[model samples]
Target: MRLTALALLLALPALRADEGMWTFDNIPVQKIKAKYGVALEPSWLKNLQLATVRFPNGTGAFVSRDGLVVTNHHVGRDAIAQMSTAAADLVRDGFTAATRAQEIKVPGLELMMLVSMEDVTAKVNGAVKPGATDQEALTARRNALADLRKADEAKTGLTCEPVTLYQGGEYWLYRYRKFTDVRLAAAPELQVAAFGGDPDNYTYPRHNLDFALFRVYEDGKPYRPDAILPFSAKGASMGELTFISGHPGTTYRQQTHAQMAYARETGIPFQLRAIERQKQALLALSATSPEARRLAAEAIYSLENGHKRLSGQLLGLSKPENLAKVAEAEAALKAAVAKDPALQARVGGSWDRVAQAVARQKALLAEATYLDTGRATLVGRVAALRHAIALVRLADETAKPSAERLSEFSEGNLKATRAQLLSPRPVHKAIDQALLAAGLEEARQALGDGHPFVKAVLGGRTPEAVAKAAVEGTKLDDAAVRRQLAEGGKAVLDASADPMIRLAKAIDPFSRAIRKQMEAEVTGVFNEQGGRIAEARFKVFGKALYPDATFTLRLGYGPVATYANGTGTLAQPFTTYMGMFDRHLGWGGNAAAAEGGVWTLPQRWLDRQVKLDLATPFNFIYACDTVGGNSGSPVVNVKGEFVGINFDSVYEGQGGYYVYDADTKRAVATDVRAILEALRKIMDAGHLADEALGK
Candidate 1:
């Protein structure tokens, strides 16, 4: 009498041309072949998958047999900044290694190459007993996943983690061959790499080099990988089918209406405001002197990018019709489940439960967010505070069983945790003080001075005074001290008289309590109920729909096709090097005044312009589905050859977090030809060019 769930799924609308951040294991081979008429073979997929590498924040790929890795300049900016000093500003002058000995190892940098993956959905889901409470189900799943991670690492000696996709619909254990001995090979000046600066960040029709080179090493020698993307002489052509191989960060396209609502109201605003505060603090610090600006360079750039991106996402969420569309789809899903008694039993209360979780999240958001344990909040940005939180949490989390510890402190993650905690990266006290003071002011504003956290942190003193004391008095900046405290554990931490440590100790109780409550109430419920919702979707849609992104490896395919620019004019898919010169001139820039400001072009580029092939493509736009973490993702043709490096998406495409509109959404990438051209002629880095071309 009624249509089956499978039938309903089949009858629903077909998938769009470019719409998924698909897992490497579940690439839509048939859909890709049918849409673009390019058949992808297993060998090609495997080779590309092996070549692609994941950074902590972005993606990259090996271009030569000698492990010459390529990624965005912004993605590699931290390494460049860290390698810099008051006497040597690498960000301004750029760097090129003439020989292997010249390359410098970047501190605290790790590159993960995905070696293998195995779906463990059944193992994870089966751990939860039927009719168990959300918290119980959550704990069981975590413990189960943690055990799997531990066992896998023990067996293979590779870094391993259980990746949850489709919310909790599927769980896969990804094993990665980790590389920590990463060295910077070559990079262009910031003026060229970030040519147009913040004004042109997420826009198309741009000119930006935005590329950096790094080499992976093993035992103090270059480590060659099994797979590398051969550089294409002719990059992507108009209407050419292309693919992006990278680890896209989180996407909320499949989230429930209640979850989206919470993000729209509380989550996005809080994050956006926090970014604003950080930007202000960094800007003020930068205004002090040249050295201060240099110290604040990496942080300021990061904050500006984050602020712009969050603003775009918030704008998309603020659209009523967007939420209404989500609501309507949710209603249809509810109606579908209502007709099946078994399905109803499994997923009927999922929506209500998620709403309840959202309520709990709202209640805890301010405290949990403001008093974070070094996971990227205003308060957590202080190096000393972050280190203190790590020590505090480590003391507690490490004491618990491996399965019961917090995710960061778990056995599988301990190596990376320790590496980051004890890194010798220099900490700028001025920047730290500014950020901490701003964070405290924000806490006071958000949680009120009467709030226990604010009162305890401020201690009747001004935020500036407290921040100054903590930053100036802390010994956490010394890597040896961090190691000593970390190795000595709780006893050493308790005995420490460092002001930052003392402050961290005072706030540890409230922070830990809030985090625990959040885990049990908000996160636990979401995982349980969200898994049920995913299960219900699986019953209907099967695996035809891709999971939400979780900052894991994925392959998204599209074409280098033009789109109407919302005004009747078709946007050009490619911009040539000549256009770059024209745009520079249009912005009132010239070779003589190269150091003017944001629109400044590096002097080397102007000096070598005549030697360059001005007709070569500089930047191009494609309908590829990409987001923040997709920056530096290797853009390949159907033949699996490296063509361009994905860097940014147009502002219209910011809605991509919620929906994929193939019509208007476009990803901007720097053409490999441009990169090679500049390398050979402008920067005089012929050796790097030869290596990239696999000569």
Candidate 2:
């Protein structure tokens, strides 16, 4: 989806003062069902499975009765990238299956379904009450939930996930069954799939034919999924009931206004800056080294997502309408609570405390760029060695087969470092320097000033010097490093006197501690805020917020058109192939833009001009609420048939995590027909196309 004027339109004025407040519990699901004439039965709801894809970080839907899954091409890019080699650049050239046998299988990836949900609010609240301190409350809540999870796991055959919803406003135990045998069915070329590229990402009038097909396989056969919905060409009708079932990662909707302010003032800015720095590093490394290029691709992906999301959050906050809505909501909530003395007393000064925290962290947050720390260098190598050591130790202590341990350790280490080494740029002098510096600092922190390795690395010389030497002195080429590690594996263990090797040995624990501290701080905030919201919401709104996602099947439905911002100007929900060419021409100067040269067409455009495929009919627009985990969700028509794959939303949609706007709000999805046609015609993957189309 292209980020366009549609974003501005979705910014509707706050709900009228007279309109009764509504929560998720009061969402009138039955009313929506009656209005759309769609069945709201649990059976129908259960048919929608949340399709979770990890690489590009998104979700999808399973649409065929025969285990055929539909998701966005971007979502599956990671798996495809993993399987690609220089000789076979799947990402650049694209992948196709001439026959069913040619289909590529993605290992260690799974599609999951939530089997059931049990509201555990009463039990959870019983353990921790309103008067407890944050730590006390957190511990109580954790213990309760832990017990609940174990009990639920025993009761349900599925994996039990105890979730504190609305932060800690409520609790629900969710049961899920995960399926691992997922295979790549088909995908379109870069031209059609990523039609408008980043310039048009998350916007309407979007020409992006961003869709892909995958299938769930089990026991050497395609899994006969019970929840698959059939596809229909005629999209969802106006005002028809539609449900989007996918994994929605997280939302800060229940956050206090102070929390929102904190995220805007502190979190978002820091993330954006960090992403920019990482992007710079990755780009430089990619330009200089082929190994860095491949290895950095994954890092680049992570950074891009962070960049896009943070950018979206910032942009979303910048919109006058969005700011107004948030202000109004907070005001209304505050006023209502003030009228209730009990509520006012309960939440007294909490918002102020949160605000103070934000203020305190503001400067540090801004400076907290991930790249400034110089931690990435020896971190991977150190982690690899530690894992190897752990495996060796475990093998020595346990009855487990030595061969199995060796294989597992070797594979684990290889997988961990594969992306780093394979990156387009590989490790460069700058990155190496930063990494070594970070590693040495980490070693000093972990092993203290007296540690032999730390002393050798830090003895009068700086990390910069050590890094320069490491890069310039040794035959530390990627292949050479791998070979040396493989051949001299036990030699390092035998030589306790080697200061350089010992320093290398201490790298892992130091890096791990650094990462652990950062993670702990982040998680602590998330959990604390989550708990607060969950508790307050339960006290105020009651069962309004739904349970946390258990990778369960769900159905979210809205409409298939652009949102009306105000004044009759509708952000047209769809874009055509012509727009692709226009965008390409507009961004001709950028190398990234030039890579989209396939869209700059005269013959292909003319030949395919009249095709409805070119007209972008199947790419429907919706104010349907979604999040990162909601990737690959099937945008269905009123008939509950698949229309497109929901992939992205505009930068302004980040705040949609809390409040949804029927106006400027738009979700970017790929039309199923376009996907099928692209695979069949452009990519020549006819067999896979037939399967995807249910032929």
Candidate 3:
């Protein structure tokens, strides 16, 4: 893993300086050394890798040698919801374990540490010829991948996943060690954690603490891993070089103009409208009562966040000036490919092929997205119909040999599918009802009310009535019922009298037909051609290109700096504790009044002990090339010292997915000094503070 500059420059010639999410094995050390006079050594990398961890949906890092994990509070909201009860509402009061024994383990939350990674591009691509038909290539690739995963797992005994990097140009087999037993240690009151609320989410000079702590356990004890991040209380200053270590969920810098257009025109708009509708619904539902509000808080906040993100993205994309830049980049790339005969033959037609696929998708988007089977999960968003569809598909796929089955339903995924289908979780009936009714109505609009499957799902009942009946009548809330149907296979599903099951059976054929058509025309074609296009891109850009993020651990760097703010004001690089208290004052005179006001600050935040150091930094801004998944990442200095916790990005940062603007778009982080101060003074967790500060 000794990265070299020649290796980087020669490897990816098209890579834009300061733009790539370089893998550890191929980091541009010479490049970094030249720019910032700092190059990460092998030991530095090992410590960084060991310190960082991946959650099911987010990222965090070890703050203590004893396995204490620190991440954004929003990342743990679902666990908070699960751990809450009638008398002991962790979400409302927040949880702080005075001692190690008091920490409660939350089920279903898992953390993973990257164990190893190996180049597997040749092995995977070896299965299909360059000229193979789309269908042939797709089938061969699936078989090779399934075999590779099974063999690797049996060999290494780690969770092995094949990462598709540079679209299809390269591949890596990433292995991870799983930690299923993670316990919630401490969390601040929601009001204090989300001080600025939705309005402050992506803005600079943020006062939000927005952090939570947890512990990873094994054999009923805190399992200290080899790779713990050394805590550094020393704060970052303006213009300091910093690096963030975490799995950024995704970025689309490699996407073609047509693909970006598809998202801008079809995907973003549809998703924004849906999010707004759901936000309105959730707000109305929560307004019903205090209890309702408590129940819906996490969900509502999520919708609000999504709404803002999409709205920002749409606004950025709609700008004609931005589109012109995008078009210019696309034209240059296309021209480069056409100029080279070899590149033309390879990636010459890729852009056009992708455009064709996108065009086809535009025609099928509505029917595909709103395709409903009238079933909802315990969580409002998950469609039981999809599980129902999966079950039916599983039966069909299972009937074939392992090689012939769809990759998703192959032997590798079957166990996970079964576990998910049979896992028990609490159901919020009202939420489920609203979701199903909304789904049914959407289905009517998309597929038309006269569609046979739509009529069957509605069953002559109105959308509201049908949805209500489905929620009230179905026994899917019980894991046993779902298990019986899933385990019993197709015959059981066909014979079941349960209204949801019957509806699932009725819609299976239509769903299956759609799946078949999509695979043949869209997915299969895209997979084959996409890889060739990737190869072409590699030829054009060489080592300079960074692959689209696949939720894998990555290293990206930037500097702590200030950016221009509209209205004749320049936003400061960091917000101080005094600013937080000042903002708190704007809420109300006292903690109680503030807690009841906008961006509620908890009573403890007004502690007199912490008052003197109100000048301490609370949160700060930095321009880092990061996207959504970077939340909760460990922001470290050149020496990899903890500086802040990467949480939200500015409104312009939403465009990071499509374009990386290092100037205006920046990342927001909770200052480590502020976290220590809060723990020491307001929360009175002096021991935890010492542990984090390495005192």
Q: How high is each candidate's TM-score?
A: 0.95, 0.73, 0.91
Give candidate 2 regions above 4 Å deviation. Answer: 1-27, 34-39, 49-56, 126-132, 150-157, 236-241, 289-295, 319-328, 334-345, 356-534, 545-555, 563-569, 577-618
After aligning candidate 2 to the native by TM-score, how far in Å is the CA of 13 from where it should be? 12
lDDT for each candidate structure: 0.85, 0.55, 0.75
Better of 2 and 3 by lDDT: 3
Q: How well is each residue in 319-379 modelled by candidate 2, as lDDT tens digits?
A: 6676577678767666666777776776544555555545544543312222112223234
Model 3, span 1-695: residue lDDT tens = 34684554343322221566777777777887988899789898888987899986689999787889999988887787778976778876788889999888887687888978988888888998877877677778777877888788889888877787776668778888888888998888787788777767777778888888999999998987777665678889977888888888877767778778878888889877777766676677777877777777777888888888888787777777776777898788778878889878877787778788788877866655655232122113744544555666666778888887767677765655665566554556666666667666767776787888678777788877876776787777677777777778777776766665655666666665665566666667677677877776677777766677889998888777666656355567789888877776776655445434655565555546345487888898876777777888999987777889999888866776787665567788999998888787777577788887767
* Candidate 1, backbone clash total: 0
The TM-score measured for candidate 2 stands at 0.73
Query: Candidate 3 versus the native: TM-score?
Result: 0.91
Across 600-691, the per-residue lDDT of candidate 1 in tens digits comes to 77777788889988999999988788888999999998778899999998877787788666765678899999999988887768898888
